[model samples]
Target: MTSQTTLIVASPSAAGRHYECRRHVTCAMDDAWWKSSRHRMSQVIKCRFLPPARRKRLAAAGTEYWKSQARKYCDFCKCWLADNKISVSFHENGKRHKENVKKHISQLSKRSAKEFKQKEKLDDEMKKMEKAAMAAYLKDIQNNADLTSQELNDILSNGEGSSKLVLVPAPEKVPVWHEVKSESGNYYWNTETNETTWDCPEVYLSLAEQEEQKLKKQENEKAKERLKQEQQKDVYKEVNARLAREKMKEKAVKQPELIKNKSTYTSTFGPAERATKPYGSWTPVVNKPQEKVDLQLPKSSKEPIPVPVVYEPETPRIEFNEKKVESLGEGPVEFKKRKFNNHIKRNMRQKTDDD
Candidate 1:
């Protein structure tokens, strides 16, 4: 029997050289070769495979590093990469990748919508709770002695109700009337007649209330009349002021020199009055001349009057030919026959009868 030892490669294959082996034997678990081989395999596996989370972190770090380097291409894959670090890989064109991206977008949209709905629901619930709390507080207050049920009902339902305590005072007793004259120095009370010329009650209202009512009534009436008068005065003043301003403007526009001496009554009134009058005084009048003495008839001439040669106006001649007459164009034409003269008388027959 021959004894053999196993060898394990620790580092990367050094200087590619083959060694002669006496036997191909498996090493025991406690052997140094097995331990070294296991350690080396663990390291190789760790370098070959990475967890998903760690891979993502490493990829993110690599993107950041690439961004800092400002490289246009990936160092590992030797492919073009965007500055945003979106993978320009064959996976991006895969159906599964596209589906995953769409699913992520849909999930984000659904999450936002759910959050918004939840906020609205929370606001509505808060408002309802506030209303309920207010109602309970109001009920509690109404249950206390400070406010009555009727008052609370009135406030809630907007209904009018009488108060428990009356505020108005009772009517006062009627005062005694006396008829005492101002001239009488002594005051007298009459029992049977009860009729006098003075000291009668003018009004039956309480002193203070009567004075206030009278003053208010008088003030109201006076204010109404004053307002009416003020309105009328304002209207008249506005009309007069407008007319005056218009007249001043017209004077300024038409006669600027009159505006300089406008303070003088002559300048203000003279031109205005002159312009208002008729222009007959500024017009010139013409007189007609008398005719000479050709009105008398001339004396008769001794020689026979020669025939007066008068040239008469010529009349327009019109010739009518019956053969040229035509019928009306639109309707059917109708013709009427004419009767001709046939009988003739001779003047020689009367001389033969007398012979």
Candidate 2:
């Protein structure tokens, strides 16, 4: 059973046709009315009708579908408005919206100017780099051309010289004989003959070898002269050090004698007495003995003297006898209670009064 019921007629009657025509007209009118109502509601500026400005939308399947999703959002004002002529016009004309739009435009202009400057700077740098690279490339090409031309000139000169029978001396061959020393002993190497032997080669010495030997002999002589000079320097330094030590000893010995000769203390005699004995001589003076005056001592009385006794006070001492005190156990005594924190109580009282 379908939820929708359909009327059936046995024949094609006028009444059936007229009923069909009336139903079609009613459906069309209802559809048109619904469309008009939806459009009118969308135009109304209601809180629920506005979408959030920062709403996240899922990516659509195609670019076209995504592009079609143009929500009524103001980028500058940072809010969603009704997508209608009246709401859009009113929001755009508001003071806050116009200020925000002006700020955005100013920022964009500043950013574009900064970007343009940076691009110009980059272009200048790139141009400089290109010019430097071209200069280097041309310089390298010129250097290569000069080298090639020199090589061609040398080849031409050689060709011209080959036409004449010029007496050219053959190149001097280098001696390949070398002496190798190892733990087993010295060995001689004749590289030209590819021979190695313990004994020295009997072949005549080449000019290079003779020159090398001469250089070695001169170097050895110079080294010997340096060693002799160094030994002489050491001897001279030792002699100088010994002389310095002897001079210092002599000074030390003479210093004590000089100090003994110089008197550091002042004379006790006055200037007149010193002038009288200016020859650094002083005579001992003897004085005559004076007559002694005799005085009689006061005689004590024969009566018995009475002695007076003096009294002295003693200090009182405090003694803490351990036997008299009670024993103190490991833990605190029960009588020893913690003292009250009066400072915290005072602070709390002050805070409470302030509050």
TM-scores, in order shown? 0.18, 0.24
Among the numbered candidates, top TM-score falls to: 2
> Which candidate ranks first by lDDT, i.e. highest?
2
lDDT of 1 by residue, 47-125 (tens): 1212234335545654211102222453333444444445555546757667777777898999999999999997986
Stretches of candidate 2 exceeding 4 Å from the true structure: 1-71, 146-355
Worst 10 residues of 1 by lDDT: 62-71
Model 2, residue 226: C-alpha shift (Å): 61
